[model samples]
Target: MILVTGGTGLVGAHLLYRLASEDREIRAIYRTHSSLHKVLEVFTYYTTTEKAEHLFKKIEWLEADIIDIPQLFLVFPKITEVYHCAALVSFSPRDYRKLRKVNIEGTANVVNLCIDFKVKKLCFVSSIATLGKPISDKKMITEQLNWNPETNHSDYAITKYGAEMEVWRASQEGIKTLIVNPGIIIGPGFWNKASGQLFTRIHHGLNYHFPKVTGFVGVNDVIDAMLKLMNSDNFNDRYILVSENSSFKDVMKYTANSLEKPEPKKDLQKWMIATGWIFQKIGSIFGFKRSITKSDINGLFATSYYDNSKIKSAINFNFTPIEDVIEETGHLFLKDNAK
Candidate 1:
């Protein structure tokens, strides 16, 4: 049997849908009862409501948190393959501690159990944020680039990098492992979370677009890459899974066209970003969520690119174009909102 963490998340949900449809004996861990809805919602995105209900019943849903070692251990008896996707994603400074505890420490615990259980293979989901930033000579970040400690980094990036360390350590301890550094994953489900936030914010009429360029991939492609890597003899390897490097302006324009909303016409100026961060800092004093920060502003304006040729070469896979990904996800968002 296979055990999957974060099985209710955007990527995890899609992974489970694929695994279950393939008639694999799968067990998925979740922290809350409400998260189950997201799993079913994702299945419904690909199939009929009745078929989704049937697929949902096929999964062995277990209530467990990655941080809770005792609870996590109970579900590992017969598990052979492990997919570690559970992580806390937060950009706010206030969430720094929680992100570290859950992302870094929790991943360490998962690594410990994988070793203890003698699991056959472990597939880890890491972010492109863990990759090094390009400098003078280097134009694109790849698996070969080493992270520079002197550079400015987000707390989320810091935690994910730490998590990658745990996975690398596990590989050293003789656990066959595969790590995927995915870009911004655009998909349909849980519209308020992660990349789905882009759809929600755009639908609600966001008017400003950042000029930053970054990597992007659809949710299905990420899952497909993970499975392909796990099934193959490729072990102790890391691949950058990105479909394309695109600017936020084009992404927002495509999104606006798909949603039938007014495209964001205003380019965010440096002064406006500075003022916004200033207000966010002031609001943080009153316990307001800090949506934007100095690190975010810098990242938003930087033109970072990723080299995805490694994964494509390894898996012999082609990624879905960003336009189609945006359009499909946009339709799903509209359909969900209409209900």
Candidate 2:
């Protein structure tokens, strides 16, 4: 049986759709109250009634948290392969501990099960953040990049790095493990006020500003790479699963234009990074939602250019441009706006 965690997430949902079509004996784990619930919430938000009903029923879901080792084993008894995707991808400072508990310890727990169950291959869906930052050589990031948590700007980064470490440690124990560090995932789904901010704001015409950030790949492309990894013809070592490094401005403009909306009037200036930090500090002191935190503000300016040639060349895979992902996202949001 194929055991999966975070099955309700965007990547998870997309993976589930693919797995269901193949008639794979799939098992899914979820936190009773998880961000994936909002993934489903977005279905009704963006999809037609017929589409929502059709997609929802096809996914065979099992409710369990990655942290609950006993419960996880119950759903995934004698698993053949495993996919670890559950994580707290939040950047909030206040919830940093919660993020660690789920992203780090929870991942460690899954790795342990791999050892106990003698799973054949374990796939950990790590993030590009674990690589810390782009190197000065301007080459595509490869498996050579040892995960460095020191450069991490957010708790999510640290946790993903730690979880990856767990997988590396488990690999030492005879569990054939592979790590795929996917960049930002953009695809079909609802935002539900959490991720909703990105979809809603951009669709409602608030995405006029862009950050000088980097790293983007499509949900379809990322998933395709994962399936390729499962087939064992790609790189024998860890791979950087990225498409291209583009600025946030390009993504925003492309999105707006694709949705037939007016382009944003302003892209984020370098000065706004500092301004955002100040505003977040003040908001934190006043017990308000700091829309921009120090870590987030720093990350906006931190990303350097990236080259995803290693995995692309190894798998002989050509990536879809960020524009394609952005345009499709725009269309999906516009359709799901619950107009």
Candidate 3:
């Protein structure tokens, strides 16, 4: 039997659809009943409502939180393989503690459970955020980059790096583990969260595009790589799953064209970001939630590229182009919101 955490998230939802179509006996944990609707919504993107609902029903739904060990323990029994996708993604300084608790402590609990259950293999969904900055003379960040603690990092990144440590420990303790550090994942559904919000913001006529460049991969590619790696002979290794390194300006322009929305004409200059960060910090003092942080400001203007050669060589895989991904996803976004 297979157990999946964060089965209702963007990656997990899409993964569940694929696993269900293959008729795999799967158990998935959910924090809320409402989130399960997200899985069905994601399934409908590739199939009719009836078929989607049928596939959704195949998953054994268990309500559990990765941080709650006792509750988490009950779901691990009889689970031979595990997919650890549950994580808290936040950039706000106020959320530092929460991020550590969920991303770090929560992952620790999952790792411990995987050990106790003697799971055959564990696949962890990690972000490129945990990866260190590219070394000198290297243009692309790769699996070989060693994280430097002295460098400033977001709370989310630090905790995820810590989580990777736990997974590495698991690997040493005899559990075959596969860790995938994916770039910004682009997909349809859950328009209000994560990279999905990029489509939403674009459709709503966002007027400013930043100059930073980063790695991006379609959600399909991420899930494909994960499944292949888990079934392959590879274990105790991490793969970077990025399709292309693109600038935010180009990505926004492509998405705008796909959505038939007005492309942003204004470039968000670094000075503007710096000014906003100042006000955001002050606002936080007055009890306003910070929408921006110093680390975020740095990320906003810094151009970072990721290398996908490792994963490509590992799986003999090909990635769908970002332009194609945006076109299809934009079509779906319009269709879903047409009502």
TM-score of 3: 0.95
lDDT of 1 by residue, 185-217 (tens): 999997777778778877987777778888999
Off by over 4 Å in 3: 136-138, 277-291
Q: lDDT tens digits, residues 20-104, model 3? A: 9999999999999988888998999999999999999999999999989889999999999999999988667788898888888
* Candidate No. with top lDDT: 1
lDDT of each: 0.87, 0.69, 0.87
> Which residue pairs collide in model 3, if any?
none
Q: What range of 10 consecutive residues in model 1 has the weakest lDDT sum?
A: 279-288
* Residue range 1-339, candidate 2, lDDT tens digits: 888788777777777666755767787776665655554654554456566566656555677788887787777576888877777776667777988899889988898888888888888898877774446635555556665556646666777888888998888998888888877766767454233345555566553464555677888798788888877743225777767787767766776786787767765555655656334322222122545555666555554555577777767888898788777777777765646
Q: CA shift at 78, candidate 2, in angstroms?
A: 3.1
Residue 124 alpha-carbon offset, candidate 2, angstroms: 1.0
Sort by lDDT, top down from the best = 1, 3, 2
What global local distance difference test value does model 3 have?
0.87
